[model samples]
Target chain A: MKYTGAQLVVRLLEQQGITTVAGIPGGAALPLYDALAERGSIRHVLARHEQGAGFIAQGMARASGKAAVCIASSGPGATNLVTAIADAKLDSIPLVCITGQVPLSMIGTDAFQEVDTYGISIPVTKHNYLVRNVADLLQVIPEAFRLAESGRPGPVWIDIPKDVQMASIEIDALPEPGRPDTAPCVDMDELRRAAELINAAKTPVLYLGGGIVTAGASAQAVMLAEQAGLPTTMTLMALGTMQSDHPLSLGMLGMHGARFTNYILEESDLLIVLGARFDDRAIGKAEQFCPKAAIVHVDIDAAELGKIKRPHVGIHGDVSQVLDRLLPLIQVQLRKQWLSRVSDLRSRHPLLMPGLENPRSHYGLIDAVASALDPLQADDAIITTDVGQHQMWVAQAYPFSRPRQWLTSGGLGTMGFGMPAALGAAIAEPDRTVICFSGDGSFMMNIQELATMADENANVKIILMNNQSLGMVHQQQDMFYKRRLFAVDYQRRSDFVKIAQGFGIEACDLDTAENPRAMLADALNRRGPCLIHCSIDIEAKVLPIVPPGASNTEMIGG
Target chain B: MNMRDSNINRKLNPEQSGKAVLELTVRNHPGVMSHVCGLFARRAFNVEGILCMPVGDGAQSRIWLLVREDERLPQMMSQAGKLEDVLSVARHGADHRVFEKLEEFFG
Candidate 1:
């Protein structure tokens, strides 16, 4: 059979089971786009910006645990996807980003819309390819998908020249993409040694990270924790690995983590780390963190095992496999005294939130919204958040029940992530309600996505926590910089409701409503996209903050 | 050398700043190096030296990373071995001459 490279690209996408591709087409990509139009099986989403396209793919990938595709023309279009690519790299999202390049004849001639797509994407992508030959498209596309979704998944790029897309090639059969190489077998001896350490320990804390969710080992992690009666604390990326209300769940532990969680970590004798790299944000002053504990680290990524804190027993395997092997080798014992002491500490220093009964207060408003959403009770609703105070507030107040249910930009802390990610999540799971929690500062970064939401008729309920300032930075300045507020305030407040309405989405102001809860409920009940602009005090802070370079135990303002 | 003897050798070395060689057998793939390097880069761990070459009909590659000896080396060895394409990782003493040979050639 004879097929053009463009046709083969579409065929390969179909072969990979890609249903939708988010992108913007240009001259360099016209052949590919034209081929896509002719094929018409894959739905093409026209994003307002390439970055939004990239993030939309990320949201889909994160939600579905599958490789998601995004496309863009070369140069600025490709450049716009850089941040999202980097975000996927930091957070390990599987994305296949295809960019159309200038014709091969104009190579390095500074041709129109030509940039080194391969060069720019190398640092941020797991692997990248420049398909100069039409026949290579067959191999490259499949390889891109394989690399994107394989072990420790991240973004992969394939840059196709316009000429190649128009070039015809004859093929009888497409080669099968190579399967991901299997992980090394777990050493039973190491598992036994780890079991011995766990059996001998009096106080053991299971510290979880994003790897558990990535590897689909959440069930195994939970089983290990419950079977051993170990209290657990998770990093930001690992939230919802254990239900928030689980008795042994200590919630997020790190910079803004609960004081009691930090105290418990400080007191534990054995630290069983799962799929988590002890990031600086999670482990403050590494030398001082879990000072008394002998660590046992298990992770799929070999690099994460001893990158920060050295573990006594470091087993390199999938979290699920390692736990499955270790679970039966160890004798389970109850740690009543340790659990009681942890409970006492938690009671003494519970996560303090401003009363939700007082809806006028900023924290109160957050509490009210979270409660109205039934965040604690329902695991179906997905919440995506932007960075800053609102992010921490959501982390502290929202009751998350499962992994991937609570989506936020934890590693990159990228602003403008909420709305687009919500769009992606909504697209991934149409039956589920998707909520976007954004502060005023973060919202404006990618506010153009409102048009995308309206265009897609995406069912995303956005809660804009409007403080008219960069609340997180402002709080830090107040505490550390002697109140020299520089570049932190948004002096003029934009009417977000009007802005949202302008984009053809229903919008409301929560601050002005006499019955705020009823108004919010009414907006949420709408079948289409909507936004609730919440005016909050700029002075309100995310409490229990550990100042930069401070030990976790030295947190203040809870 | 057997895995048990190697474990004993690692335990005998206590100098945290001494140099160590990690030799990895990995499937030959474009992204394999990126995955290996990205892991170290994410943790801000530096690789003092690197040597990679394909082995046995280009199906697999052997990568030798020279790094400072720290308590984390054992764990890092375990981690490198867990990468999808990685078949095994063997640690060597600083006296291993791979990097030295490369230095001599470069010099």
Candidate 2:
């Protein structure tokens, strides 16, 4: 069958087993859309915003473990996909973004609806190509897919000039993606030294990071953790690597992490950090972080080993491969005494819920909301959070079992990220219940994402913690800013339940505990999308905050 | 200062083997550091760290490289030069004035 360059891209995607696409058609990209529309098998999802499209693709990629595709037209459409692309790049989500460009002749001339998409997307994407010739179109498709999915997956951009798309091409076969040879060499001697450290330390803590997930070494990580019987705590990006309910798992580590995780990091004699960098968020004060511990940093990216905090033993290679070689030589012994000490800390700082009798407290409401979740299947449900007080609450309360189930803007504390990300997550994993935990200020950022959910009929439950204020900022101001509420008060009384209903989404309001649990359970169990608006106290505070420039020990909450 | 395209075919025999140079233009940005290094990753090409200076009205930058023979020279250089803030791209070696002085001095 004869095909144009536009049709070949779709054909290439179909050949690679892509069953779905998320995009909006504009004039410059109409031909490609026309080709897609002509194909009856591929499911195309229309996203309200181009950024939303990219994120939905991201969600799909994250859930399905394959490269998800998103498309956009020239100018603003292509530009709008930038943030999600960047997000995918940082988080290492595999995505292929196909964007329309102005005709080749008009590229540098600033023609109508044109943008230097290839140039603009360079830094944001893993690999990108501008199809200047029709003959290159076929090669660009497979190359983009290869680059996006191989060796630490990331988003790749293919900016196809309109003329190239319209041009006819005789393609034989797509070029097989060449293997990248960039991984840093691992020295067996250094690996043996790291193993020696693990074997010698009595109170060793495994601080896992996003690298484990990026390296797809969760199984290997589990083996290493279980074999050594060392307790594990993960960074925000490392959530879902170890089942939250697992005996050794201490959920998220760092500022908002479990008290036990921090205490262990502070007291442990050794820290075996896997695929995790010492980011400020994870290590509150770099100089003081893990001061007592001799760090064994294992990662694929050699640059990350001692870039932030010094590591006594740096093992560079793929986490899975390195762990495979190291685990067998180590002795199997549980650190029972250290584990007992950590458990004691866990009880002492158990999420710090407000006293039950305090009717005005927001913590009770948060706990109650958390309690309403289906405890039996809670592990299966995915929780996505926007950055704020609610995010900390969810991190502390929600029990996430699997890796990649808890999605948040960890690398970039992007507000308004939760709702869209949840919608994307739900579309990606249709069977699993995807929940969006967002505060009023955060939910307002990309509130329009609700329309996208309603349109897609996604099984996403948006739990808006309506505090009517920027809770985090308000709490800081209430404590530090002399109670000078200033502009933190979101006193504008807007009824979200009504607004959601107006948008044609199933909506409910929970003001009383009489049936809150049942209502929540039912809402999460619903077939399509639903919104649960809770009237939370505006002055609520997420405590244990280490004020700016202060040490971790100087936390607001005892 | 020794920057030339590394795409030219080279003899595989030990007696004929020699180093080739590559010049790359990249956008001046925060993470451009990694993006530049990543180009040489699996190409059997070793890049001695880029010697870069601000150019193109302070918006763009040029990366000078002393590289070994690699097949991806054109693709890598073009890809790097296509970065957001990149203005233009070219390779300079013994024939170019800037690189010639350095080549002569090293020789």
Candidate 3:
């Protein structure tokens, strides 16, 4: 059988069970797009920009816990995808990004629309390939998927020249679809030691991160917490790993975390750290963080073990596997004294929501939207947030149900991630209503995706918190930079409702609504795609912020 | 400044030469070297000397690096090992003969 390289790529993607892809077609990518149009097996989402396409792919990957694909033309197209790919790497999302390159004959002549996509993507990707031969596509395509979604998933890039895309290949049979490499075998000694530490410790805390979600070990994590009578705290990435209202749950910890969470961590003697890298935003001053605790860190990637806080026992294995073996070894305990102490700390330094009752306020807006959509016990909403004060507030106040229910740019903190990502989530799961909680500054970053949303008619509701400024930056300037506030506040307020309507989606302004809560219900309930804009106070801040370079215990405000 | 002088500035006891060698076995691919070097450069880890030769069957290569030993060497080694192209990493003292033998050619 004969197939062109472009057809081979599509066929391989189909074999990998990729029914959908997001990308922008360009001059270099024309042949691939032609094959895509002809093949008609895959659903191709036409994004306004290459970056938007990349994030859409990321959204699908993040929300579904599956490897997703994105495509781009060479040169500027590949450059635009750098942030999204980097974002995936940092957050450990499974992504395969394929870019079109100049013809092999053009090589180093600085040909039109040509860029070293493979070279540019190296640091940002887990692995990258530049296919020099048409025949190599058979191996390269499957290898890209395997490397991408394997243990400790991350983005992989494959740059194929235009000539290669047009070249023909004859094969007896197509290669098998790639799958994730098996997780590392857990060591019994490490498991016994970890269980022994948990069994013996009087004051133990279970720290969860995004890896918990990736490993699908949330049930085990929560089980261990209950069985061991351990207090649990999640990083922003690990939200929904333990339900927000679970008794053991201490909520998100570190910068912008609850005051009691950090305080409790300080008092703990053992920290069972699972699948979480000690990111600066999550750990604050590394040396000062959990100073009293002996840590037992378990991660799939061996490299992450000693990279951050050195663990007393570092287990390099899948979190689920480690927990499965370790759970039975742990002796059940109900630490009444520790629980009583945690209760005392919680009562003393609880997370304070100042304007929570006011529907127009930051925290209130998030809560109101959540309740208005799925007020009952039904869990039908997927929440994505752009990075800002709004993101933190949602993290603090939103009642997350389970893992993969909430998606946000946790590591890279890219501003333009929310809208396109929400669209992609909606595209991936059409029955679920996807909400993008975006600030004015962040919403403007990929506001063009509103048109794409309208085209797809995806079920997405954009809750725009229009502070008319970069809220997080403004708050930092106010607290740290002597209130200079330069470049943080926007001089002009753009009418987002008008903009959303102009993009051919339904729009409503909460500022004008007599009953904002009712209006929220109306917009969310009847949403194919809609923008709900509400003006928030510029002075509103995500409090309990651990000032940069300061210890988590030394947080300034709440 | 000598190694002892710098170690003194950092308030640590100076070790012998403060140098170490790393030997990496990697897949022989066009960008494998760049991937290895890029990890070092991005993390601000210094590589003092470098050499690579394709090993048996031309499908794999062995690379040797002379680097100033620091507390970050373990972390650097872990990061290097995480690269897809790299198969294994072995650490040696600065006295390793790979770079020592190449000194004569340079001279």
Best by TM-score: 3
Docking level of model 2: incorrect
- The lowest-lDDT stretch of 10 consecutive residues in candidate 2 chain A is A355-364
**Models, CA RMSD each:** 4.4, 8.9, 2.6
Off by over 4 Å in 2: A174-186, A355-376, A479-483, A512-514, B1-107
- Tens digits of per-residue lDDT for model 1, A1-558: 899999999998888888988888988889999999999999887888999998888888888888989999989999999988889988888899999999999979999889988777867877788888998887788888887776678898888999999999999987675345466689788788899988888989999999888888888888888888899999999898999899999999989999999999999999999888888789887767888899998877766655677677888888877887888876777788889999999999998887667655666766666667644434788889999999998887778888898888878889988889899988988888898889989899888989998999998999998889999999999989999999999778799999999999999888889999888777776667999988888888888988888888989888
lDDT of each: 0.85, 0.75, 0.91
State the TM-score of candidate 2 restricted to chain B. 0.55
Q: Model 2, range A47-66, lDDT digits (tens) per residue?
A: 88888788778777776778
The TM-score of candidate 2 is: 0.82
**Predictions' DockQ, in order:** 0.15, 0.05, 0.38
In terms of docking quality, model 3 is acceptable
The DockQ ranking, best first, is 3, 1, 2
Clashing pairs in 2: A240-A402, A240-A403
Model 2, C-alpha of A98: deviation from truth (Å): 1.5
The DockQ value obtained for model 1 is: 0.15
Q: Which pairs clash (backbone N, Cα, C closer than 3 Å) in model 3?
A: A544-A557
Better of 2 and 3 by lDDT: 3
Candidate 2 chain A TM-score vs. reference chain A: 0.93
